[model samples]
Target: MSFELRRATVEDLSFARELTSQNMLRYYIEFELPWQDHAFDVAWSERQNWLIVRDSVPVGYVSLSRDMRALYIRELQVAEAFHRQGAGSWAIDQVIDIARGERRPAIRLTVFENNPARSLYERKGLQVQGRDECFLRMQLDISTPVL
Candidate 1:
């Protein structure tokens, strides 16, 4: 049940991409959005990413970016086999700590409207701040104590 976060490397690209596709393709289809593989590459290049490893195997990853106002979670995908075992929640807690350490005012992310992960985000204190046809923008203000 112990998990560790390791900085993702170039070699992790394929694994991250495939894990994301597996978890998200259904939503893409449901929303009628095109699956653009290059988008992952673009984000991977621009953002900071980490692999969630259990023992020695990678079970998921989280990608992040930062602005003066907040730390943004660009992507967080957990392999199906590891879901409900706390990998996702642990990642979020790590992100919260990162934001706190960086003195960011908040943490932000966009989740597909029906994605089950939304509940996990909500449980972690991120509230829905806005929404579009396909996504809900959520945020957790960490300027004050949140631990």
Candidate 2:
């Protein structure tokens, strides 16, 4: 299936919210409806950091927000059927492309220590920059990876 990423518009909000809810329920065991409302509010309030699309049947969702000086990836989820494909990788690459387009310093995110996506992030150039007992503070520096 072919896919493309574009800025979210008002017309796409409902679809975005639907995709968000579906993915959240399937992948995020800690999901909450109120949080989804808050996220929708934040994402729609400022369209700078959210992208949602369905190449065919709504493959995934991702939300990135700027925090302090660093860009924080607030959420990313690929639909159950779309997992293990390149949907996520392309979405994340788009995030990096956005960062590059804006000339940002880095992208930072927190992930559950046991989550499988950590491996994907690591392979895609994200690293554990800091951490606590439960979560890892990962950062993707917008520079060439070390060889």
Candidate 3:
């Protein structure tokens, strides 16, 4: 199956809310943080969010921000029905390509410490840069050959 990502606009807020509420509640539980509407509010305003579409239907979303130093992945989530289907991996590869094409030195993100997606990030060539109480920061150095 082919996948495409399109910029998500305010009209897509309900789509994002549905996906996040269904699939991402565990992350908040694991971190002992309460889910809040403001979380999505801030994300909607602050990040470049995209919907991952499969055959014209939205199945997932990824939010990212690019700064002079790095391309940061704010969030990545695919519907439970789409797990193990390579959509997430493909999305990450697309983001990596974006970083490389834009001449960014690295891609950076923080995964909740116990989130299983940490392993996926590692498999995609991101290294554990550091960890704090709530999250583990990871970085993939796109300027090097490892990617």
Candidate whose TM-score is highest? 1
Candidate 2 local distance difference test against the native? 0.71
Stretch of 10 with least lDDT, candidate 3:
138-147
- Model 1: which residue pairs collide? none
The whole-model lDDT of each prediction reads 0.96, 0.71, 0.88
My TM-score estimates for the predictions, one after another, are 0.96, 0.72, 0.92
The lDDT, on a scale of 0 to 1, for candidate 1 is 0.96
Kindly report which residue stretches of model 1 are placed more than 4 angstroms away from their true locations once superposed: 144-147
lDDT of 3 at 99: 93
Every model: Cα RMSD to truth: 1.9, 4.1, 2.4
**Tens-digit lDDT track of model 2 for 69-110:** 667777776767778888788888888887776667898888
Q: Whose lDDT is greatest here?
A: 1
If both were scored by TM-score, which would come out higher, candidate 2 or candidate 3? 3
**RMSD, candidate 1, Å:** 1.9
Candidate 2 global TM-score: 0.72
* Candidate numbers sorted by lDDT from highest down: 1, 3, 2
lDDT for residue 144 in candidate 1, whole number 0-100 = 60
In candidate 1, position 120 carries an lDDT of: 100
Worst 10 residues of 2 by lDDT: 26-35
Name the lDDT value of residue 45 in candidate 2.
57
